[model samples]
Every structure is written in C-alpha cells, then in structure tokens.
Target: MARITYIEHNGTEHVVDVRPGLTVMEGARDNNIPGIDADCGGACACSTCHVYVDPAWVDRLPKKQAVEEDMLDFAYQPDPKRSRLTCQIKVTDAIDGLVVHIPEKQI
Candidate 1:
C-alpha cells in the first residue's frame, strides 16, 4: 500500500494507506475523504473527481490519456498544468507518498 495525502480546499488533510491497482479517486472514496465526488465512479467519464496534483508529485504520476484530458475540460476551475481526473491516476508503489489537493467544489 502507498501513503497518500488528500488536502481539501479548506486545508483539511486526510492521510490514507491505499492499495495498488486502484485509482486515486478510489483511494479517496474508499477512505471516506470528503472532496472527491466521483460521480461516475472510476470510469474516467466525469470531471467530479477532478483534483490538483501537488507540484512535487505531478511529474511522478502517469500522463493523462486522451479520454481523461477530454473530461478535464469539464472540470471546475481546470488548470491545464495541474488539474487531473483522480479516476485516471492509478495508485502504485512508485507514487508512495502522493499528495493531491481537492478543489473548492466539484460542480
């Protein structure tokens, strides 16, 4: 399992141990973190699971695919350099101490 930290818009932080083979969105949802709505579950079809990867960890994550990039256009307050769909980020040992920040709202 990897140690992941999720920070909310209000600065609330949640640290969780996430198993590999699951998406970061699943890590948030399964741990009961409040910020990721993930309306479409882990299908990568919704922007509700949008999040900003910490600058330090951004380059460590996998590049977004075409489908995830397309959906990010619908994310609230999208930031091309940092915005990402959590459902598109698979948890792995390589990202052991990943950190992500949740936006103020999902809609």
Candidate 2:
C-alpha cells in the first residue's frame, strides 16, 4: 500500500492507504475523501477530480496526455504548474508518498 495525503482547500487533510495500481481518483473515492467527485470515473472527460500536486512531486508523475492537457482548460482551479486531474495520476512505488491538495469547488 502507498500512503497518500489529500488536503482540502480549508486545510483539513485525509491520509489514505492506497493500492499501488489504483488511480489517485480511485484511492480518494474509495477512501471517501470529500473533494474529489471524479464524476467521469477516470475517463479523463471531466475536471471534477482536479487536484494540485505538491510542487516537489510534479516532476515525478508521468507526463500528461494531450487530452488531459486540454481538459485542464476547463478546470476552474487550473494552475499550470500544479493542477492535474487526479484520475490521470496512478499510485505506484515510484511515488510512494504523494500529497495532493483539493480545491474548494468542483463542477
């Protein structure tokens, strides 16, 4: 299991043990973390699962696809450096301890 910390916009944090092969969105949904609605269910079609990867971890994630890059355009909380759809990030040993912060709103 990998330990991931999900912090809400208000600063509350939910740390969860995630299966290594699961998507970050899956981990959040399975753990009942409040902010990541993941409405499109990892299909990369919705921005509901938006999250900000801690600066230090950004370079460690797999490169985003063109579709994911385009979807960021629809994310209200979009930040070029940190914003990412949680569904696109996979939980793996390479990033064993990842910390993601959630925005206040998701639509």
Q: Give the root-mean-square deviation of each candidate in angstroms.
A: 0.6, 0.7
Candidates in order, TM-scores: namely: 0.97, 0.96
Q: Please write out the lDDT profile of model 1 over residues 1-107, one tens digit for every residue.
A: 99999999999999999999998999999999998999998887889999999999878788889998999999999999899999988889999999999999997
lDDT of 2 at 22: 96
State the C-alpha lDDT per candidate. 0.92, 0.92
Question: Which residue pairs in candidate 2 have backbone atoms (N, alpha carbon, C) closer than 3 angstroms, thus clashing?
Answer: none
Q: Write the per-residue lDDT of candidate 2 for residues 1-107, one digit (tens) a residue.
A: 98999999999999989998999999999999999999898999989999999998999899889999999888876999899999999889887789999988997
Best by TM-score: 1
**Candidate 1 — what's its lDDT?**
0.92
Off by over 4 Å in 2: none
